[model samples]
Target: MNPHNPNRHNLGTVISFEFRRTVLKPKFWLISLSVPLLIGVVVGLIALSGQTTAQRVESQDTASVTFTYTDASGLIDPTVARTAGGTPVSDAAAARAAVVAGTSQCHIDYPKDPLSQPIDVQGKDLGLFDSSRYNAVATTVFTTSIEHKIGNPTLAKLAVNPPDVQLATFADGHATAGIAGVIAPGIFLVLFYMAVLMLGNQMLNVTLEEKENRVTEMILTTMNPTTLIVGKVLALVGIGIVQGLVVGIPASIVFGLLSGSMGLPEASAGVPTLGSIPIDAGAVAIGFCLFLFSFLMFTGLLVAIGAVMPSAKEAGNTFGVVVMSMFIPLYAGSLLVSDPHGVVSQIFTFFPLTAPVSTLLRNATGGLYWWEAAIALAILAVCGWVFLMVGVRLFRTGSISYGSRVKIGRALGWTTGR
Candidate 1:
């Protein structure tokens, strides 16, 4: 067998060993299965709560509410009151008597100066009335009456029938994409966040565990440190892919069901639901590539850090910086949402640690230039290679030094003897 090729048999053995050890662990199964299950349960509860609320509102609106009112100012004619969906009573005494006798659901008293003084409302069950609808109707009646009295026909006409302003953006005289432009990016961002958080922490813990338990020494004796690291990293990537599918598929189904049951459009009028948002296959492919490369780069850095630490606790203490770098995009999420092409977003796109999320967001939002994305990906690939080489060197040299923690500068100074 050639020294480099080292028999495909050996590499397979290493990969199989790592894969089985990881996949069969109870912790792995727990995390992979629980996340999607929890998300589905929560979404179901929320949908049920919303449905219950809607039923209550519909029931309330359908119930008849006979309202009697006395207009002391005489501005409100009996016709106007009737048209406004209220029964006109002859006097305040009549309105009050009707309400108290349960003949009417509510009584309204319009003051002498209806505009200047507050309107007094008495109801047997205040909750039964939709205050918003009643307030709107009362406002229209008072404003119309005042305008009529003032003799401003134009103002009255404008008040009664406001100009319908349908705002639209034209791309070469055609309407551009609607709410999906805003929403699709948000969905991509969330998915990217979940993937990185779950996979990155797993990488960190796995790498640190080998160092903490002194297993690196035993493994290094049989396999090249670089080979051992590569095999483990590949195994973890496989695990991550499985875990992502496990969580994402069920969550997506649940989200779709929730959106449909709630009468959410697949992307027309209001908040865009998952089914409604149009996904660009090409953009998604590019985003996946970026995510993959970024994950490798982050895992490499974590593995390098773990190799230098004396124990898992120490590695964790220093892992905060790496975690913070991964989440820098989250901290600047507002800037990305408000102005994806702004200076802040540009900085994030170019910076390796923040590039994955920033590029995905800009791509999803249709703000990323082709050249910018190409450059970002190139930078990420290079950084990932450098990190992998550095991690291999650190693990090779520092694995035997268990007396104290290895400084990063010293670890970087060490080189593989080719």
Candidate 2:
């Protein structure tokens, strides 16, 4: 293999090796498969329990629950209890006797003014009745009796059909969509953050592992450092994509099922569901570009940091810093959600470190102008390229220079031969 033209074969070999080491490992498969399966099992059991409970509730609802009542008020007509599907006993003792004899499940003693004076309600098992329905029935009995005594039966009829007010909400001059609009983007942000962190950590660990085990020195004999770094990063990118699909597809399906089960509206008049949010091909393309380049920029920094660190422990500290930087945008998430195009949001969108999350958030919430997205992507692409070049320089210089730790300033100086 020619030294200058050896990238093709060498790149393939490195990718293949790294892929097997990380993506194709037994643990990766176990975690990827087990998590979703466990979630599904747990959810299924909960749903089954809920269904059993609902069936029990429905059966109780259907069973006749006779109420024995003493109308001490003298205003309540015995026909009212008969009409309401209840038996009216002459006195409280008779009512209790009826309950004991299994002739009635509940007993009510009405006062002269049921609304002003507290009514006595007793039952064998109060839990057997749907509380809300039982309350409504009791209220109806009292109100109807009062209305009949007052000679205003029409008022009682009107009370049963009260007026309702419908409510709607808007944000930024646009009507807020259903819960999907909020939930879908949130889900995207979380998934994106997890994928980036997981893959970035993996890349960092691989870089540090090679350095710690002296594997880089042996591999450096056959190929250029640039080729090795590029290949490994590319392999990690592939693994990230595959891992995303492995996790994302099932999660999406489950989310869709849950959304449907919960009776979330598909789409409002002008608002979009998760499925409908992109709205056009251009937005989709730009969003993908932002995610890809943003990922490259962060992973490149992780690789560079890993190359410079002398041990896994040191790499961990650097990894924590980078992870914390990613979370900075999350702290101001409410501001971004409320005002996607505000000053602070614009700063996050333009800043390379926070651009991916900020831009994606803006895109998901309302959207940014095409020009804004283009500018952000351009900035991210440049940052990613610069980081990649810096990582290559760091990897080349620091790969063999073990024993002493590599300082960032010295590494830059060495890259310039100063």
Candidate 3:
């Protein structure tokens, strides 16, 4: 039997058994369901809290204002101040007439000295159409005045921004919708963070599991350790994908149903929002690709460590080395979000193992070089080969021996027939 053929080495049996345990196990389902459940509960709680606050503000801010504009032309700016906020009133005469008819709240009188008040609506508890009956429109009119004063063009199309008086986040009212706007991006940041840790840690567990059970030896007889290891890593990656979707779905759905953004208060609510907590398809693809490749490379290293370590405890020390390699890339990816083209980001982008995470992050938030993507992929592929070679050496070295830890010096000396 050819020694290089894993089938002859007993590796194939282990691969099949690894597939069965991972695919049929309840643990797979647990991992898949975990992220989603966690995200749903957190988002639901936040939404609930925001709604409760909205109700309190609506009730307390009941002061109203009525503008009496005797003349339309003289009524220059019939802005009203009231329960919600302030707005410019173009049809002041009609509104004023409504006030006389008890259909409106207050009136704005532009006395001959226009500069004295200078087209600004003053006084309090004001509404153009009467908040008691038409509080909604009345509130709109009050806030429009402030939008005009602020020189916002969005008010022209939207004709309303969060009421100007909502000058402070909670201002006179609860801003559940406003705050929702802020939470959108926050959700993505958090999910991305969770995915990395979840996938990375799981990869570690799996490598240790195979070694601890002594299954690696059984599988090496039929398939090359490289193929066996790579396939197992791919399968685990598929599992991670399932987990990510489960968590992101509900947060996206609930956020979609509500109005506005995730921001505590959108700089201007009602302005078109990106809406739909979307993961960039390109970013997701690139990120996952990077994650998977990085995962494979690390998995190879893990497998080798697991194979040689006498027990799982010894494996922990080996992981420290893996952690060190990950640190630079993790930090680079994070900072790349801020300045993808910055010197540090550009430097890390060239490194194969670290490049995957950093380059993808740059692709997601910051624009990275077009050529860098291809380069990063090719570089990682090569790195994967080198890691595969090391892993096989470790496996071949320790597969037949079962004793204390396998030292690196003896492990590398395998090629020299030491």
- Candidate 2 lDDT by residue in tens digits, 13-108: 989998888876788877776656665667567667778878866665455556767777787766766777677666788777877787677887
Best by lDDT: 2
TM-scores for all predictions: 0.75, 0.71, 0.58
RMSD of each: 5.7, 6.0, 12.2
Backbone atom clashes (below 3 Å) for every candidate: 1, 0, 50
All candidates in order of TM-score, best leading: 1, 2, 3
Q: Highest TM-score, which number?
A: 1
How much lDDT does each candidate structure score?
Answer: 0.70, 0.71, 0.56
- Candidate 2 similarity to native, TM-score: 0.71
Residue 42 error, candidate 3, Å: 1.7
Candidate 1 TM-score versus the reference: 0.75
**Per-residue lDDT for 204-318 in model 1, tens only?**
6545667767677777677777777777777776776677667767776776656566544344333324564444455556766776776777777777777777777677776
Provide the lDDT at 67 for model 2.
79
Better of 1 and 3 by TM-score: 1
Give the clashing residue pairs of candidate 2, or none. Answer: none
